[model samples]
Target: MCKEKIMNSESEKDIKISKRKTSYPINSELLDYLKSYDRAFKSPIVYDDLLRYVDNYPILDKDENDTFWQGVIYGPQEMSEIHQNLKKIYSRLTSDGADKSVDHLFVDSVDYCTFGNSHPFRIKIKNQFNDNHDYFYVKKADASRIYGLEIEYILSPNRINFLVFENTLVEEHISGIPGDVFIEKYLDEHTNKIRLAKEFVKFNERCFLRLLGDQRSYNFVIVLTPDFDEMQYRIRSIDFDQQCYEGKINLYKPQFFRENLDYVKFVTENLDESSIKQYQHEERALMAKRMIVGKSRLTKLLRVMKNDQIAPREKSFQLKTEIFELLKDNEVLKCETMGDIVEAVLNFILRNYQTSMTKLF
Candidate 1:
């Protein structure tokens, strides 16, 4: 009798567990659509989702008393708003809808996973703005779990596999560097194009200085042309939403851009030792400083602000003061390049912290 009772209890528990489970599987069609966007299969969020999917992620059981969803619901009203926004974006791309088709399609996938409510189906569309233009990635506002703010990412038609870079914070800003810049060929035929090397570095440096922090891979891209010359390199920023705000943008600063002409010249010469020692030293020190300051700033800002990345007025003022003190004295203040400025600010923070600790002890 005791053994039968134990067996019965185990069976009941398994049945209850199975009944409570939810599956947010990515169907073949959805995977096909994602591939059509030409994006890397492995996204940071997607990886996290996959782990949950495989490991039987926990979700709250629906309460019988509270029949209403707690979070922001797209339920008809929000969907209309999203539709209007898409129409507006579509109209901007085309004055008249004659050139191509604008098709709205729905795929059975979780649009969002939030604390209150989750959207089980995702709405996507194919926009043919023009002949040469690429299809745009579209998404609607879905209630967020980690951050209440709507989380969305525009899918790109042209994608590059950057797995080798390990997806750092800085790499997300750039798309690809120009790949065709052979030194021998450029010198023999087109020497003027050599100036592009400096311009490329300068553009990235300016962007880096403007952001102040957050440098990682997948944020930036380096495209090298066939010749292997630095001058012919084309650099493009992939992520811009995080330009001025806190984590609101999810981007990195452009401090990693190499600026020194001698360094560029050495790279052009195929990694010669002319400025190798100085280059390596500067790179290491700058990298160390960037990590320290970036992490410190992120932690301090996060403490003061919620998911919105906005802090109270008084808190903002205090943060600014702290940051100011950290960066009051550093050689990077004199730097003309974004790369140099980042290094300078990093050094400032490190020096400040060390000095303060010394006095305290």
Candidate 2:
């Protein structure tokens, strides 16, 4: 859990992140699972190697705002070698370790971020010939984050591409406008707001069902698609460090966050309770279908999780009890681990996807 505090008595609601969290190492079982699923790769460069930067400078966005990233500088002797290895690792993540596609790519910039639990190093690679650029991240491996990424890939509509090395993790960047920026700049400009509203409800439901927490406005993104008639919107989570770790029930629900009050307002003003319930039902049914398709993989992953220590025992027990009160199901009460709770919740969704959504509200 993020040693954070939420003040619901004051204004609307406020959530603040505290200092460092307890680090959980990747156990043997999770490593085996990654290797079996081909998500394990041997990278020539590890996370500690990137920490050798001799100096760093603060970075700024085009709008002259702080981007919360530091432009890392490395010694000339080590810079060339590190960038080359990073490019190759990017190749493995994108093309299953083929380097032929990356001969023209050059590392443009390397930046380090201290904003989240991962404290990841972001690499920007650009095509020398066409100037087309892309990004990937290198971060210390944590079992909780790895589980979040895997579950999101399997259950969510978005596709996640990532790899796990010994103590390192490599992940492709999720492309979209940040949720906070979208809400601030574009929310008033669009005449057709119903599509975004519906997507928000589904997005809210998706996070709660999967127990993904701390999704304030900035933790997610908004992807806009051009439909035949109107614009279609999809909400995606960019950060996955808080997966099933928080003790509070409202923390898993995005609608309860203070930063997301604007979105909550939009949802409440435009969507009726019945419409919201219908969208929740639709999202659950879709998840049930996905679960059926990814049964084998999900089963193996959950088995590893059931025996793993992703969160403190006290927190898990608290969340489990809270969920049991809502579900009135003995299965949730019988859960001894967060993994078991997740598995039971999944079974509940499979069994009551169409009928039990009424309890969600």
Candidate 3:
């Protein structure tokens, strides 16, 4: 038997994710599952269509910092066609295919980022009447990312809106303060540091529970909402490219990321062990409840995922061994895919919940 390489807190600091990950094509079963749930749609444009732009210029932030995004320019005929098709896609995303609603809407700018695995294109749409604007993304629909998005929607507190059309994916822009910006500017000024820390703890638990990895500061956002007397903070992940790909379990926990060192320190400084444990248990309980409520949909998704090949076999084997050791349950060792690993994790949580309830009774 091979020894499980479970990462400890000390080892987590040295963990590094691979620079590049192979994109997996969506298999027939997953596509059918997506179509059954209305997550699949037909779009006039595909991911390759956007790559035909002739030229591009770098986009800058308000502080004159390089955002690593380029504003792409297209030929007159191509631009007109792309813009019109994008508007139609936006209509379908937001208003259930009401094309007339987008008659007054125009594409303001199209930006592309070569930063990560997806290499997504950002589309800015504006309403001519009120000058109100919104953003969406177009990217190659990698099966791993699609599964991540679906899992986030089904399990997390947040609701995700995205549509898959052939090889393209359209996602509604998640609105919030970038995590790095929040850390730099808002962390000190936050009226309720405890609440923010608490939310981070919950967010950390959510990510690890679902095996969502590589939650560096920039990959997530901080959403602030006014709560009568004070502001409430919620952390939401913006990137899903790393979903269930890493072999290291600690990679799923955001606190282990160096980019999130500030958050980790805050959590340690403010939250004692018991408080942290309470928050973790609370999050797990909530997730268990969500699992029960979304059982049918989750079942279908997992069925597709278990049969899909989203990660390397070595990674799947390593992760399953580590998880099996950590939980002291042989069930995880039986998992052959990342999806099976996720199913095992969820089952572990549900089993623990049932045991606790039985003890209470």
Candidate 4:
């Protein structure tokens, strides 16, 4: 039997609804920021164009299980037009409008998912010469998701490449083993369980500090890399729809998710309170350093985010109050939007860093 008995804590139960009802539209200021950063482009195609597909079939995984994806098929003339436009877009994304590099590439399949908030279409491109393949996503652009992508690019260790054109957002695929699959298949085989636990601690801290939410096991992936002697694991969030939209503070922390109980159990079993605190501090320091390095760009983005509305007032107020209660700092109480909450968190980190420095003098 699998060692799945470790997730029995009362706190492991699902506490809040995980889905968001509506997506916030991208506003003007955020659009300007995207345009300024070369993230906005003009495209011959938009998200609605893909909806003209005549038929679709259920996409199945290797085990013949329905993957919640439909293989979209368009008529010949429409397919030709779409394939050409998609190739051009792919060139723009990867080669800065150099179409010759992807001349030999062809669109293999387009898969759409209707289950989630974004309702993204997954595009698969393959090289005719060597049959090498790559994937990308085309989704209707949402302000919250855009902010999440930018924050992940700036604040996290990973760099993401994406572009916005009108209502469509194109995201480069992030490759990794889905977290649930990793927990089911690789958890027992992983030699360095402590490192895995440490990574989860850091990931939890990162998500909470940035106010990202809904990071259940299915929403993120675990990447494994071979170190000189051992393996290193990194957990990256793939779904960005729920970024900073929840009322409860615990929603921002991945450890609170029932689907991630295994990871939480790992941390609780292998790490003591002191170690967890150290990991959190370490992540915070790294984030602070990243902020310093990207100060100009980050500040500009935050300004746009602060002026934009991504969540309801009640949700924002609840989050602000919870943050203040947690820190015993009332500054967050003045935050009006989700962006303001994020700004308050950043400022709080800076203040803590400065105080620590002053103690050394």
Candidate 5:
């Protein structure tokens, strides 16, 4: 298989996502779920508090290009108050809310970005003795995004570190090369294109399974690790605003996005359809194992999520039909909410895998 193998796949121009997505409120059920999982607590700084900034200056990357973020300015009196609380919030997210953990840390920068849906405030922290810095983000706590984070934490290999309060969400920064940059600057020089392609297939499958949408190249990240002999690659979703919110099925799959066409083509060139399918199965089996271990927590989440309204009725039904087209399972038709749809799909995978295992014996 090569370029012609995926001649009909999507390009960047084919997809037109909404310019802005509606932010769903975190209702009581979701709040309870977060609390039960230790993901929700009182925060010293709320998202609205950060909005009281006086002005902002555009931020630039090392190449002098706009980074789509701005350095927020605040009054000196208010700045000191906010920075101290922000340091406290960081300790909560990373150190289980210990007050003394942030004594040596200082808030280096409070940057704001209005380029996307969340309009998050990026906080940069530096150590007093050493210049080593770390990053975190404070954003409006949207319920849909919370579900995405929980699903990633429960199902994916990557762990999500975050905390949520009344209307604020604090998340540790996900460190990786921007996916677009890796595709352009590192792919040609990557040590193991085949392994990378396999991971792409698995990543694509994982996104589709969880109904996590809008995974364009720039929206996610590429994590490269040096194995003893070869390079291992991983694709991690950094943005979760679109989790189970879109109507179109393709939106859930990263391979269909125009920004990811290069990876799609590279995959076609290096791997056959059978190899792609094998990787997808491997990913599903791993997720199913995780589901078994996290069964109680996942069940609690699904119950809460099904009662929460994250998507419009029309969009939810549209997605149900589209998913049924591929999965051909009647359980999908029973879904009344976006959460129900997620549960159905996951149960479908888990049940099918369990059945096969039973038959093997």
Candidate 6:
């Protein structure tokens, strides 16, 4: 009986080892979980440090116009804490077999006064972080507000300050908002602004398909580089924590590019037809292929998410549904050229939406 029991225990051990070998790696496991839930798992360590710094900093008494004196830097006490988090992330990036240090991969210029509660910073890396360099959004976790994480990114590396603000253009309420009104409210005299916004939404649809969440307006910015005598606004994502989706889900659709017609009309009215066609082509070319995952891997991962007994909630659920209803006719996204995307990016900047309360009628 003792001999039989020993043999059975050995067999069980072998099965467990085999399972471990066949199971997904730890990094992939965590990434898959985030994708399944449509959530960006912000780093806890970074969030804690940011909180500590913000807590001790003395609020500035100056007026809002003095953006530079906002006292946005993290407090002195948080220096050590921030350092620790940076060290940890750096260690991971430069671990035994890692390709490069995070800093070497991207230039780091920090910012503390982001619109979001979390502190924001600029990351200037070459070769685009995973072919996503144009712009990416990332979140650092916190126990406080659910949207406690910060959203930020630079549109291009060659600019005055690559760290530009990305305004989500959506209202703060999170629910009961109309998408067209939001854009109209922020629409600018420049025709390019509307075109840029539309192109951005189209690009965003790609992100949604990958199971990445929180593609808020404030999460990214449009960059305009002066070429010869002309100016062009390009779209780029700043945050990247959610780029690697474990699931193989594709949410691409024509409506996503055309659902909000009012906003599109508002934007296109300011542009020439030639530019619009150009943006349409650029969007299509980018969406033609999925470069991030292999067929087998994507298939297996998406299946796991589908099989999991979980129901996910919308991250920006508080936004007014009435406004989003306007998202039903987004004609701007249908453009087939970079010109439309450029027009869209520029139009928003021209609108100067943050301080505008003007009557469009």
Minimum summed lDDT over a 10-residue window in model 5 is located at: 1-10
Model 5 regions more than 4 Å off: 1-6, 10-13
Per-residue alpha-carbon lDDT of model 1 for 278-340, expressed as tens digits? Answer: 443333344444545456433333222222322233433343344345446535334432223
TM-score of each: 0.29, 0.93, 0.95, 0.95, 0.96, 0.38
Clashes of each: 52, 1, 0, 0, 2, 57
Candidate 6, residues 1-361: lDDT per residue as tens digits? 1223222332232211011111112234434533443333223253333434353233343443423212334655565455444433433322432334434343232334454433443222233356423212222322111111111111212212111112111011112223433454535565366546455434444443232333333334455556685445544443333322111111111122233333334333444555544544444333322212133433444333333322112211211121124233233244222222222322332233322424543
lDDT of 2 at 199: 86
Flag regions of model 1 displaced more than 4 Å. 1-89, 94-133, 139-200, 223-231, 246-252, 256-361
lDDT of 4 at 165: 84
- In candidate 2 the C-alpha lDDT for residue 312 amounts to 85
Candidate 4 Cα lDDT to native: 0.87
**Better structure of 1 and 3 per lDDT:** 3
* Runs in model 6 lying further than 4 Å from the true structure: 1-28, 31-46, 53-55, 58-78, 81-216, 238-266, 270-282, 291-361
Provide the overall lDDT of each model, using Cα atoms, as 2-decimal numbers: 0.31, 0.86, 0.89, 0.87, 0.89, 0.32
Supply the global lDDT for candidate 3: 0.89
Measured with C-alpha atoms, the lDDT of residue 12 in candidate 6 is: 35
Off by over 4 Å in 2: 1-12, 15-19, 354-361
- How do the residues 13-34 of candidate 3 rate in per-residue lDDT, one tens digit apiece? 4569989988999888988999
- How far off is model 3, as Cα RMSD? 3.3
Could you give candidate 5's per-residue lDDT for residues 1-361 as a string of tens digits?
2234345674335766767888999998888888888998888778999999999899998889899999999999999999999999888888877878889999999999978888899999999999899999999889999999999999999998999998888999999999898876776664577887888889988998999999999999988888898888898999999999999998888877888888887688788878877898899999999999999999999999999999989999999999999899999999999999999999999998999899999
